[model samples]
Target chain A: MEMFVHDETPTAAVDQREQVVSALAGSVRDLVDATIRSTVADEELLAVRAGVDALVARLRTEQRPGPAGVRYNSEGRSWSWGNAVVGHGNAIAPPLAIDHDTERGRSRAEVVLGAAYEGPPGMVHGGVSALLLDQIMGETASGFKRLTMTGTLTLRYRRPLPLGPVALECWIASEAGRKVTVEASIGNADGVAVEATGLFLVPRWAPLAADEQPEGWRRSAEG
Target chain B: MEMFVHDETPTAAVDQREQVVSALAGSVRDLVDATIRSTVADEELLAVRAGVDALVARLRTEQRPGPAGVRYNSEGRSWSWGNAVVGHGNAIAPPLAIDHDTERGRSRAEVVLGAAYEGPPGMVHGGVSALLLDQIMGETASGFKRLTMTGTLTLRYRRPLPLGPVALECWIASEAGRKVTVEASIGNADGVAVEATGLFLVPRWAPLAADEQPEGWRRSAEG
Candidate 1:
């Protein structure tokens, strides 16, 4: 894929940039899974780390002081490159590309877990499950145009989730003043193994008026 | 303090061994707090790690394979040295020593987070809060005599928890077949900052006969 930098004016160039970011994010996600499941020797592991460090150095030649926060363009294109959930540059996140069904008030994503996420034998780590759930639930609560923080999360592991491809589905269960409830689940091709319910809060301190177009706050909140 | 090896005789040694283990656990807990809050330089960090590695080597001179599981004696004394909540030899655990009051169905622990636990500026990491709460709520659900696994946990951070000394309290709210509910909170001495609720399940597959002797299952469940 060709890389396109963001431009001063919103145009097809911006959309192309987003596509490149998405493609890069997908590759990074693949790297994560490979790192986890690699049977490579310790020497190889150290060598790989060095290679990654060099790549990071190259990126640092021109970069911001801190993480990439959410950003959006006038054309309504939003991007988050440092997000733990969907960051295009974060290798730790699964290759999860969430598809928001705005009309249905739901979202779904599919990803595979490999060695890096393993906890017991061949199963995914319990904490990894929680991390994925948090992001998806948080997004469900926000519904693509609002802001929410995870106020609370509940999870139940009905069975051990195998290290393989899985599907995650989430939907807004209910919404109240500053509080949105979300329900989500993760399952293998065969059946569901884990289920979650979460309460997300738009802190009383944050702006409640979705109509108000604040700058950084609105950008971060929307993405 | 002198470390005393357990005696082969079952009768007199049980209580004596328990006392020694408890004292050692206390010292280990202190070490955790010190490690967190220490302003020691990088050289000191390396030296400390080396010292710890040597100690581990000495201990491993004669040992079994894999991680330690809960152990008990014929005299009915039980110990768990690999527990995430109350392990005696685990340096990863935060400095937490929970006190259980059976009569009141309550439990409390005090801890201080430091550089190692920091997430946003001076605030404790969100995952660290979840970890600490999981232990307390799990213990509260177990009531120190029965087994429980965290079936579900929910937390609300009303405000950012500063990385410093804090108090945590948990108590049972209700119970229903194989499920115990716990309510807990963490805060600075002045007031509450985070509150949590948990639903702990005594897996249906686990033995439910509380009337059984020895209580190995119960001891393992507290984590």
Candidate 2:
């Protein structure tokens, strides 16, 4: 029954702030990857931990009362820096930008799987593949015009997804009264590595639009 | 064809190191969550950003040759600190500890979904739900005795799962040839919140145990 609705007036300042924070989050994300791969001495690593903790304390001095709930301006420009899939402020989330063509009911995305996403020997984590596919499929189902939740997801890792540039494609496969099925895949230049099919639910509380919605669905800048 | 094999001797030092590193990674993960929740002033945020970036630069001075490929010690003790689902070195990964009852052919996990994992309004991200299920299911399928990859995942979000302490359970439903079916669900103090069924594939290259094998599968100390 509870969901985020960013149907508000546009705020240029908010957008600008997101960009600023996202850029910083990006750096912090890089830091995370680096720290994981670092071979620094135990002494130095321990010393750096002190400084990192200090920075955290400073940043925590003034904090949001709770989680950074999803927000949007009047223009429907929504931002959820805390989202696990596309949260700009979250380093744990893969920095993914999904582009959807609502008219065609298709979507495409590109991202570089880094060291932080490895699972096997040099391959992208299988769980990460599912995470990305679920997000894309949910977005394709919702498109911002309507709210949709993931109902079921099916994934097939046909081959190893190297830790580097990867592409993902998704589309609405079928739809019924309250159930929407989405198909998606992630791959590299060679070919598809992981394929996915998902079923999304349109909560009874939030019904589908009776008429075709305007293209404002692209405001998932926060999704 | 390359995969992580822990069919060797186990090392006590490695386990000790993991415990130490995981403790540090836990602090860093806290820093990440704190940063996202911070509402510091623009001036303070900017100043802190510089300091954070500097620390990152220092850490990046020396890096792993590449992604920290999965490593298994001589004692067959395997440690994969880069896995997105259960890597101890990864701050972005949910600090999940999956426990499997090989005798019962079931698995159980408990974790606190923090701000980084939110998708809907205060609910755990649907994709995160899928991620966790896939990992637990895969582990259930493998039981850490053999290799398994998620072939397909089906999930149903019965309702919202509020942020905070959550529990998950998984078990093998059926198996035929190379396919293993796993059923799982995540919930809080309440009943089930999200239910999942996954089909895991045991590739021909990595077949099941052919004979009585050593009990090297310690159920993932940090799973």
Candidate 3:
């Protein structure tokens, strides 16, 4: 994966960072799928885990202490590499790259599930589907510029989702003070497998002003 | 841990089967916890994996030909061993045993989470907390005499919850034709850790009449 360290580039450096982050995310997604489908032997698995642990330790030696909160540049670009939904470095994320259509208040992403996400035989784990829906719905509720937390989310699994390429879509249904409602779905080429509705809340404790919100809120909602 | 099967008395016979199912579920939960916390040598882990695979094969020797759908009895007892939220035989569940107070429209449960439920260091996984809340809220919405599915749920993690015993409480706030609203919370001996609100829906496809409602819905919602 490509790596970069903060330097003296102008805040306009956002575009370059976005590109690098996207490429890394794609690689991480591929890595996850490989890890799942690999027919590697036990000894090989142990060796890989050990290598990964060493790499983690090496990164820890140079990292800031604490979770990677969201960060943004003056040019209005933000990134969150530790995000459970869309983090570039999180192998567990299914690494979805969601695209938002601002005018339509909608978003969509495509992803593939492999062994790591399987539950029933070849079917994707139900919880994994819920996690993806949660993120997309949260993004839809926030509309890329506000703060929202999953207040409530409901999902229905009409059929088992096989482990393979799938698509996800989400859009805002309604909004109220401190509350936004979102609708989302996940499906394969055949048809929709799961449907979801969410009630996302900007917690009473959270700031409501657009400019005063934390960067984490912005990145999660927008990206 | 308790066996209670008898073929003579109808209720006793049913209870006996439930006991066996419960024991299997307990074993599964134990297996999950063991897998998470095991620090066994690589060779031992491989051996364990082989043993587990063998056991799975043996169990499949006489298994049903289809998914374990929800089941109920004429006497109004119900069991869903494969339910994601409260399945008696699911290793992934904390296996919550919820108690309802129909008169008060409230429900409560106690459970202990171990290594398998960890997210942050020494803390219960956030998703686990959400899972527990969903089940309880769904029950509250149903009032133990109807059927309801989660439509939306909102949670706030006021603080990190340590992995150990926790108490959960839920109560209905209001209801409409297809919607039931619920309020819930989770805490330990010290105090509350998280609070939740949820909206549950009885799918438009589901029946509304008390007499026509499925027995499983009646027991889960009313019990």
Candidate 4:
């Protein structure tokens, strides 16, 4: 069973669909933020709920039987629209745009968490910070050239991260055969908030020279 | 800087709003699932987007300036409607109905993992598991009697948890001074998939004898 599959969908078609679905996802993100902060009267909320249900029914008219797994075309273009962290169609995900410098084994993203991602008052949830670091560090280890699965993740809560703009960075600390050690952190101008050290492993079944087809393994930080 | 506050919203009013808002969140969750698997034409997607935008505008007519913070009433009814793990108003939060037995120092929740939470093909995202464990363990440590913040969390992924029904449980392993040690896990009939150990701390600023008013600190696993 190949971890990455060639689904035969052309890159252009995938891009077009992504644009439309991403626009919808963006609106849903706004809806979530608004919903969290809305103090409207019950009557207004009920009316809006009805409207949302109607939209949902309309969209359900056409559907796929299961989740959108990561897919790549024969031309080597890949996309993961259902990913928990970077899926374009996932409103739950903070809009994270990672910049991967494969040569330096580093990856970074800047995001502003809002109401939906809150844990404590005016602060980003510790778990949310872990979620972001895991995704970024996993990507850093994979480098889009090989498949990597998280083995162990350890986090230290150095300080509270406020609910606003924050930066995340991860780098390859070391590697031993199939095991890659990654160090990551999430913070803002004040310094690191949550620091993480993760061990990611390239499964034994993966091809040894998968790097020759790096594009096929790309997982949508650039999608 | 009190972590738990008596916001003065009447319990009855809070319950009524929770019912209405929870219904909306349920609908939104279904919408997310459908969106992920949808293979609809671009024209249809665009139309759905427009309908969604209108609904969002309707909801935004009257809104709070910021995120929803945890609040409680004089009657000691507490609600965290925006919590990432247990918020009734948060569509992104899985429907986690936690059963907390304070006397036993244990907390458990049963949830069904779905498409939107996917990471590896058909499997639950690693970070999502961490998020759930952190919340459940934190609640177990607090026992709704004292304020506890996550100090450190370490996770080991034993196996991939599939996207379906899963169970989570946490217990207070030990305690030393203001620090509490908690052990938690997420698994199914096959046994544990992920195991975690977390350190929870009662900040120096929190008053002692908080157990006198446990209800005042109760958060929304029971909302």
By TM-score, the best candidate is: 4
List fnat, each candidate: 0.05, 0.59, 0.02, 0.62
Tens-digit per-residue lDDT, B1-223, candidate 2: 3355453535876776676667667767877788789888767767777877887777778878777667776555677777777888878777678888977789999999888887776778777887788778878888777666667777777877887899999999998888888899999998898898888877776647734333333332111
DockQ for the candidates, in order:
0.06, 0.54, 0.05, 0.57
For model 1, the superposed segments whose C-alpha errors exceed 4 Å read: A1-31, A203-210, A215-223, B1-149, B160-195, B202-223
Q: Give me the displacement of residue B3 in model 3, in angstroms.
A: 29
**Could you estimate the TM-score for every candidate?**
0.56, 0.90, 0.56, 0.94
**TM-score-best of 2 and 3:** 2
Ranking of candidates on DockQ, top first = 4, 2, 1, 3
Residue-level lDDT of model 1, residues B21-78, one tens digit each, is 3443343333333333333333443444444333333333444333334556555556
Q: What is the lDDT of residue B106 in candidate 3?
A: 91
Worst 10 residues of 1 chain A by lDDT: A1-10
Q: Candidate 4: which docking quality band?
A: medium
Query: Can you list the residue pairs that collide in candidate 1?
Result: A36-A116
lDDT of 4 by residue, B1-223 (tens): 2255567778898899999888877877777777787777888878888887887888788886776777888886778888877888877788577899999999899999888887776778888888888888888888877778888999998888888899998999999888999999999888999999999887886744555545555662221
How many Å off is the CA of A78 in candidate 1? 2.1
Q: After superposition on all CA atoms, what RMSD does each candidate show versus the true structure? A: 11.2, 3.3, 10.6, 2.6
Query: A1-223, model 1: which lDDT tens digit per residue?
Result: 1111232537576466444444444443333333322333334444444444433343334444333445556666655554444554443445367888866779999987654444333455454566566667766677655656667677777776766798899998987788888899988887887798888788766666666535433323211
Cα lDDT tens digits for candidate 4, A113-161 = 8888878766787888888888898889888777788889999998888
| Candidate 1 TM-score versus the reference | 0.56
Which lDDT value does model 1 have at B162? Answer: 67
